[model samples]
Target: ELSGQWLAHVIQTMRLTYESLTALEIPNDMLQTIQDLILDLRVRCVMVTLQHTAEEIKRLAEKEDWIVDNEGLTSLPCQFEQCIVRSLQSLKGVLECKPGEASVFQQPKTQEEVCQLSIHIMQIFVHCLEQLSAKPDADVDTAHLSMDVSSPDLFGSIHEDISLTSEQRLLIVLSNCCYLERHTFLNIAEHFEKHNFQGIEKITQVSMASLKELDQRLFENYIELKADPIVGSLEPGIYAGYFDWKDCLPPTGVRNYLKEALVNIIAVHAEVFTISKELVPRVLSKVVEAVSEELSRLMQCVSSFSKNGALQARLEICALRDTVAVHLTSESKSSFKQALEALPQLSSGADKKLLEELLNKFKSSMHLQLTCFQAAAPPMMKT
Candidate 1:
């Protein structure tokens, strides 16, 4: 059942015992526990962590100087095969049998019996590892290197009486486990530096002298793009009708939507990069100021299409002022009506709340201006 990151964590911490003789199992443990251990070992083998397990064992052996044989094995004080056989005998105490257990050495009769034997084999393997690490010198003779064995491989040659079932085959594979040889390998991972700095690079690339020029260029380009003219739908233009030309513009005569647009542009920039949100307001205020100043220059010109637009605008204003004078003299309300209707309709297309508020303020201001202008007319007419 163990898999993924949790199993990886376990693997990271697990240490394997090398240069040890196989030994006996602990008493009174369940048969299922041994089976589970074998299954776990099989999982490790399939994942090729047995190679890593060998590396860990080799690491431990090098630290202890346990390597002694021509065959790269620990010089055991006692016979390794005898030790394994003894361990298997001890592990059989877990089985609920009568005083003398006889079936431990014999070929297993059933699949269940085979499973029971396999579990005990795994238990013996584990026990031998513990004994080898704990008491390497107790029975092991330092004078002799490797012990004489009929089969040199850990589990020896398997003399199978019959072809094993798939499950039995798996258990057979697990029996030998991963045999650890005592040769040393350079673990470069131990020397690797830790990566604690999130996404930021720990090293800087360019020198201070070079960085200044690059930073200046970047800043200048950003300013140029941001401070470009606020044209298109936001600008006021001369809307021509079939009969007369209406000079339509927002009363405040500034691009009210540009502030929101600039803010959104900043927000998107922050989204696309690892930027501090706290820096956005400062950058935004500067950008808004620069862009607002650039856009304000357009207010001086009346029509976007003409170079003499400002002159024509002056003439129009003069004409309006004269009309105002005449209206004041005659007590007329026509000029006031035209000015009110000439302003853009915010209710139709202005989606932003700021624009709605600006529109309301403009309405109130224009209304007040016209009302005051008309109120003064009766007096001028009397005069």
Candidate 2:
């Protein structure tokens, strides 16, 4: 079944049987019975083909590397797409007879059959995708279980291993889903139209809707995984060394947390761009927006800002703003602006000079990180 040779042979034999049955001058009633049986057989073949496709996709998904990278640094359609295409090709060969080739009974019904098959194929693909990306059930509550604190390193190693594996699986799924939604599925729909398949609109709409919903959910999961840690560092970084926003000295430069956040953000930018340049802008935009909003909330909650503390806060925010300047969406920009407005305005010429110097420093650092990110990207994607 996986080889598809059996399917091709069966289809050819059925075609021959239909032709022979028609040529024999068999009675109309007997002919109808034979035609029905052949049609049933064809339907069974289609079902088997769909089942094989689903199984193939699941098999590929279980592998450590589901995305088949044929060329170094060049994004390719995933193995799942190939599986679907192969199945479609096989079905097309059997279901779509050329002009003057279809049997009398099959002629009038070919378009409708093709349409129904197309929808079924799409449903199978979507079902397989959902299964491939489904998260594992939540772990049983471990709080009640006593911990072996003495084996801290062992426990840490196991946790890290599991986390890394889960992250890689998620990356594979998202990259593949993005490619399918943006490229493969559109091409498939176009092919269906070229074949004059009925129900193309509904098929395309339902499949696209499902893919898009999955894509969005995957994106949100990714953002949470990547951005949460960066956002999580905000409060600690802000209050590092017991630094009080209400009683700090004049700003010297951007704080360590701001620097750390920028570094982490750049790293994520590089990782995502390397994986799929198509995902770079949107993913980075969301991550930056999330971090900015969190920063805004944190600053707003501060009871009061000392004169110097406010100056320091403005400096840090400006540095952050400049660092992610390229990736900022309107929402993130608004968040940053709001956070800045909450700070005491810096009117002193010296304060302005200090802020300028800090901004330049952070911008320089950001430029360096971006340079590294560009270098890491594929040559074709450098633009």
Candidate 3:
């Protein structure tokens, strides 16, 4: 720490001397030496700082407990949050001028330097996270394993390492990223602006863009991880026993497959809401849409369906829609509507009446489950 501070002081002093010599109209040849020295010292300072920051982040990534909760629901910030906090603090310490130093002692180019240094440190932080959470060569294995969604232990089978599952690690990284972007980065920008730093906007934009891109990638991966198994189960659950659609009777209640799928979907909602409720709607919307689209496709592929069979399928879809109505995007809602339309319509007055009664019962049952799911959600504002 002392050496770093000493290096910063030397760079600051050299910069001041360079400016003073230039103001006096010193010969170019004479000023060039001081300018070169300043450049060299600045490079050394940045390197030392970056190397130190990277090492700290790597150590933290290795040593810190990444899991917030064993059951995967908690209001606490992610374990790696300190990695980012420390990096920002380190940057501030290096760039901040001494309190007693004159404003002129601060170089005009300090704002640009801050922006560059900030980007470098953030990049390092992200790289460390990438390394820590990286999965081994299990892509092919997971792809094959995920196919058997009928298995109750599908996720367990795919991730049996006894550590954080890939999806859970992703959530941790994503939660940290969101916190950094929304809170920490904003605070840093504000601090810089308060110091009359120019070009802070550029820093905020570049950093935010990077984090947002990572957020998007993480969100998509999570959707894939959680949604695929649920969608895969839909087929066997809906078309159980190779039962011909023509022989399908009027629905007694939601099918076991639909019930099981909803339970799983609600469990996913609970998990995400536990870790990051702010992301719950966005995450679940995509998951629901994927499931809805698959159900629609399954309905379209049906070789035969009695009116009662169609009614059963429609009831299942409606139950799904009602359960997650708040999270449904316009696309998901349209998919559900289209899936309903794809079902055979009932013509008899008695059939229509029966459908309505069954629909009402299904809605009531689903609404109760929805209530329970919502009740389980953590408060919106973190304490």
TM-score of each: 0.22, 0.74, 0.71
Candidate 2 at residue 306, lDDT? Answer: 90
Q: Highest TM-score among the candidates is held by which one?
A: 2
Residue 31, candidate 1: alpha-carbon lDDT: 36
Estimate the lDDT of model 1.
Answer: 0.30
Residues 1-383, candidate 2, lDDT per residue (tens digit)?
33345765776786677678778887878766765665655655655675666566556534332322311111224455566677767767656653334331244365555556566666666565556556453421111111223343565311111232344445556777776777777887876665445667877887888878877887898899999999999998888799998887877677778878888988887666434555677888999999999999988988898988888888888777766777888999999999998888887898888889877876675676646333234446554
User: How does each model score on lDDT?
Assistant: 0.30, 0.67, 0.66
Question: Best lDDT goes to which candidate?
Answer: 2
- The lDDT of model 3 is 0.66
Rank candidates by TM-score, best first: 2, 3, 1
Ten consecutive residues with minimal summed lDDT in candidate 3?
A: 139-148
Deviating ranges (above 4 Å) for candidate 3: 9-51, 67-114, 135-163, 194-198, 363-368, 373-383
For model 3, residues 243-303, the per-residue Cα lDDT tens digits are: 6677876678777898888888888886676555666777788988999999888888887
Q: State the lDDT of candidate 1 residue by residue for 1-383, as single tens digits.
A: 55323444442333121101112333435434443443343333323332332233333322322332323233221233333333223232222222222222232232233333333332333344433333433443332223224334664422223322222211111111111111110111111112111111111111122223333443444444443433232243332332112333333322235333433444433321212222233333444444333333433332232222323332333223332232232112333233323333324333234444544554354453333123222333543
